[model samples]
Every structure is written in C-alpha cells, then in structure tokens.
Target: MGMKASYVVQPFELHRKRLRPARQEAAQSESGALKKAENLAKRMPGAAALRIVADDETGELESATILEAFGEVPDDFAESLQGG
Candidate 1:
C-alpha cells in the first residue's frame, strides 16, 4: 500500500470497532431527549395552570392574565430566573 492510502485508513479502521458503543450512546441520548419532548407534548393540552414568580422589581418578568389556547408558556420563562 502507498503511504497516503495507509494513513487515510489508519484512524478510521482503527476506530471502526469502537464506533458501535459511541454510536449507541449518542442514539440513547437522542432517544431520551425525544421521550422528554413527547411527554411534554402530551402534558401540553391539559396545562391549565402556571405560577409566575418574580423576585425582583428590576426584572422584566411579566405574568399572563389570558390565554387564547392551552399549553401557552409565558415569554418570560427565562426572564423569571433573572430575579434570582
């Protein structure tokens, strides 16, 4: 084999056997994230209550007094954390 050909296959062929576990782990992590998304979607339709807590007056967090539909998350979800 030529020098370039041998070098090209070195890392790939060497790591071929190790790819399975790494791929499996990535797949498992993706599956878990998908499951969480599905669960949240399922709970969305019945989300009738939300508690907004603003600990600082300087914070721009605001609470919603009306919802046109269910599962409506406030835009200030992350802003609410700024108070702390």
Candidate 2:
C-alpha cells in the first residue's frame, strides 16, 4: 500500500443564506490549488485550497487539510473537510 497526496480547489456559493460547495477542481500542485482558489473566490462566494492524503490501494482517507481559504468560507469548513 502507498499513500498519495492530492491538491484541490473547492469553490463555494451562497444559497438561501447557506454556504454550499460548487464544482471542485484538481490542481497539479499546492501552489496551483491556492492560485486557482484565489481566482475563483473573485467570482464565487468563497473558495478554498485543500491538501488530501489517502491510501492509494484502499482509497481510505488519511487526512484532509485546508491549505488556505478565500473570501466568505463556511464556519465549519475545516471540520467538514475532516469529515467531522
């Protein structure tokens, strides 16, 4: 088994006074994810850069981290990312 790391940009939208996730995008690197999230935040309610680590063979999540958050992100964004 091997561990794999991934970077992703998640954009958020406000709906009925709630922050909801929009389409998610994969990034080549952490910096790329951060840049993408920052750009998306301009036109979105919020955006976040995430780093996720998991087992490649089992597809089990090892951890999820919020690298950065832009604009009006959810108050429980970090907890949500951790599947809490």
Candidate 3:
C-alpha cells in the first residue's frame, strides 16, 4: 500500500485537427520533467510536465498534477489528465 510519486513529460501532436498525446517520457525529478517538456514543446505542438502519485502495490493512480504547460496545449489537458 505504498504511495509512489513519478514525474513525466507528455508531448502533444496535432493529428487530424485534434491534439493527441505522443509517447510519454519518464523524468527523474519535477525540474527534469519541466525542462524536458519545455524542450519538447519547442519541437512539438505542445508539452506538459506532470507529477503523478499512485499506489505502488496496486498500480492505481491516486492523483495527477500539472506542473507546467508550454506552447499550444489542449484546453482540456488538465481535465483529461485527471480523467474528468
């Protein structure tokens, strides 16, 4: 029942006039995630850094927080992340 936190960078690409999530990248730290997302945004349509906390044993996501967004991120990006 341990809770583990992870940082990730999610990049968005425009496909068929819709913003789609690209392959996500795992980061070592929050700062690393932000830096990676910023760099990726320069090359892609958009990128967001996130902090995800989950139950390590169950592998169930507890929460996801958007650390930062760069460029043209989707309007519902945060809601999408939180699965709302």
Candidate 4:
C-alpha cells in the first residue's frame, strides 16, 4: 500500500458576509503549513481566516482523509475527520 501525507493551509477571504477560498499552501507538517498560511494571510489586503488541515493518502490516490484540523475550523470539521 502506498501512503502519502501532507499539511495544507487553506486561506479564506470574507466576501458578502461569507468566507471563500482565496489561497493555500501544502507543507510537510501542520505547523509549517500554518506558518506559510499566516504569512500569506498577512499579505492579503482584506480580512481572512487560515485553516490548517492534515491530509493523509489512504492508499487511494482519488481520496484523502483529514487527520486533524486547526485554526478557525468548522464545528463539525474535526468530528467528521474523526469519522464520527
């Protein structure tokens, strides 16, 4: 089985009172991804939110599972990641 791991920083921009994907980065670890996201967020001209997500390839290239999430994550995000 082939397994892959990656950390992603998903930046959200506020528009019309809703958040939208603005920019993102993929890193080797959660902290690294979060740091990159924060730097990008600081450069953005508007208000934004950065989310750190851990993604792991479950031997299936078409699908990836989230192992953990942090920073302005949704209430159900973690729960869903946990398979609850």
lDDT of each residue in 11-83, candidate 4, tens digit only: 5565686545565556777567656666665655322222333334443333344433333434454454346
lDDT string, candidate 2, 9-34, tens digits: 99999999999999999999999999
Note each model's CA RMSD in angstroms. Answer: 22.7, 1.0, 1.2, 5.9
Query: Candidate 2 versus the native: TM-score?
Result: 0.94
Q: Which stretches of candidate 3 lie over 4 Å from their true place?
A: none
Model 4 error, position 17 (Å): 1.9
Per-model lDDT: 0.26, 0.93, 0.94, 0.49
Candidate with more favorable, higher TM-score: 2 or 3: 2
Candidate 4: Cα lDDT at 72:
42
Local error of candidate 4 at 46, Å? 10
Which pairs of residues collide in candidate 1? none
Local error of candidate 3 at residue 79 (angstroms): 0.9
1 against 2, candidate with superior TM-score: 2
Model 2 off-target regions past 4 Å? none
**What's the residue-level lDDT of 33 in candidate 3?**
98
Worst 10 residues of 2 by lDDT: 75-84
Backbone collision count in every prediction?
0, 0, 0, 0
Superposed by TM-score, candidate 4 places the C-alpha of residue 14 at a distance from the truth, in angstroms, of: 1.3
Best by lDDT: 3
Model 1 regions lying over 4 Å from their true place: 1-34, 45-71
Alpha carbon deviation, residue 74, candidate 2 (Å)? 0.6
TM-score order, best first, reads 2, 3, 4, 1
